[model samples]
Target: MKAPEGADLCFPLLLNNSCRKPVPPQSDGMLVLLSFISLLTAALNLLVIISISHFRQLHSPTNLLILSLALSDLLVGLLLMPVEILSTETCWFLGDLMCALYYVVDFIITSSSVGNMVLISIDRYLAICDPLRYNTTVTLDKTKICVCLCWMYSVLYNSLILMDFLRHPDSHNSCYGECVVVLNHITGSVDFVFTFISPITVIIVLYLRIFMVAVSQAQIMRSHIAAVTQQSSVRVTAKKSEMKAARTLGVVVVVFLICFCPYYSPSLMGEVIEDSSSSSTFVVWLLYFNSCLNPVIYAFFYPWFRKSIKLIVTLKILQPGSCDAKIL
Candidate 1:
């Protein structure tokens, strides 16, 4: 139970090769809270997935992007969050291969989430800035293609970024019980640029343009031009719906950036980057916390999502024609 300094050892028989059991970063109450977070995140994202996937009206191009994002967040909750919680209070006894596999999956899911956000921004951009061609440009099939490309690119890119480490999984580990992945400065910086700065720049720019166009359109619509005829009124109503969708998804993007910035701040300050350690405990969980917040955002902003939740909760979603039942 105890090592030479009265500290806990993960593998007592292994002596020098064993890792010291990490000091708990949080109290027992905090661990319980973390457990609650893990469950809530998985549950919320699952509902989002079901809500969008099942409801026929919710299966638009924008919602497809949302579905992609929810899938990535669900993986974060189901796989990464629980492991992170355990690793904080204990050792990674999941073995070196599993460790390597875990980080590989982590990077893939994270990169895909960024890719999904970028796609969402572009979808909103077309909807607001170029409404004339928006329907033709952002079709369900095209959105599905883009989502597939995003995930495929993430897998390929992260595999290349982690190629050396993947081949020699234990090279960075100083002990038997810890799962450590250290990216050289060059690799970390490249990843920071591609995954963080580049995608974030695109998201912010697209949303800013969307905001400007939305405001101008709202002004025009309010100036009585929108009420001139029945057709104009219908068009104005359609544009308003698009604007509302943009606003809701914009909140999702802003929250994502707030959570992700801290995790990548080390690179901004020109420091070494490491994954899965106590030092990064807070930032990592903060990033994971974003997963649960998304569906909460949807619940507040999108009535369809709220209604779907009620149906799912009441088990009415199990009945026939439930998916066809009007949600929007």
Candidate 2:
């Protein structure tokens, strides 16, 4: 696999003329496993989204936002992951046109996931801090607007990649014929800002505010309950519920950081170390892990989801030969 001719000097060292080689066979098994996991996770999340949408009881604004997020993850896992796995395995079997489409879909889904986290954080903050105004402030219309703005902003941010690709198609250094959006240092810096830095800043700030609100609400609720209820069991139960909610949110935040840090850290480091292969196969897999993490995290931290799964399983057992299936 020869590097493309007359590529720009700004291309990463890995894409330089001397670095091109046959696809490594060492990681084929890992790629296949990751691809399979991504496919299964995507399927499960899609089922959850569909089940929640079909049931009117799960129609709250928070669940609606979660369903949207699950859809985005599903798109990433279903459309992008297989292509990525193929590229890693066989050195970009897809042609240029398909690669470009993959790039666009990847950008949209990744951006939407980050955007959803920010929106969810804001929702949690309002629900805890401004409970009196949450219903009015986060109405259906407002939620729609917020979701639209997130998608629009993501589209705009990623449009620059298309523009750059169109302007310098010859400069693409990847053997797969994929558009190398961040070819040079300047473009790489811009990509980091748009994809990593900005989103991380927004997510961190929003979660901080959310955590404060949750803590304050828990304190106030405890005080009110203590004054009204003389029963020790009632106070303990209320405290336990509040603690469980806090733990769930904490798990969400931690999973976000763990899954995203590897990718973003390399982007930041690339600014200083121009010739690093730090963002290689391992880092790519770490980024891909994020799409699979959310549903598992939700199941681990939320009792409702667990209960729903158990009910579905029991129903399936009772209806032994029935083809009817449902996800909860």
**CA shift at 34, candidate 1, in angstroms?**
0.8
Task: List model 1 lDDT by residue over 2-35, tens digit each.
Answer: 2464457888888767778899955689888998
Best by lDDT: 1
| Candidate 2: tens digits of C-alpha lDDT, residues 241-326 | 66776676677767777777766675567752121121255665666678788666643345556655554556642455332333
TM-scores for the candidates:
0.89, 0.77
Candidate 1 TM-score over all chains jointly = 0.89
The residue ranges of model 1 lying beyond 4 angstroms of the native Cα positions read: 1-6, 224-253, 298-300
lDDT of 1 at 239: 78
lDDT by candidate, in order shown: 0.84, 0.63
Pick the TM-score winner: 1
Flag clash pairs in model 1: none
Q: How many angstroms is residue 146 displaced in model 1 relative to the true structure, after the best TM-score fit?
A: 0.7
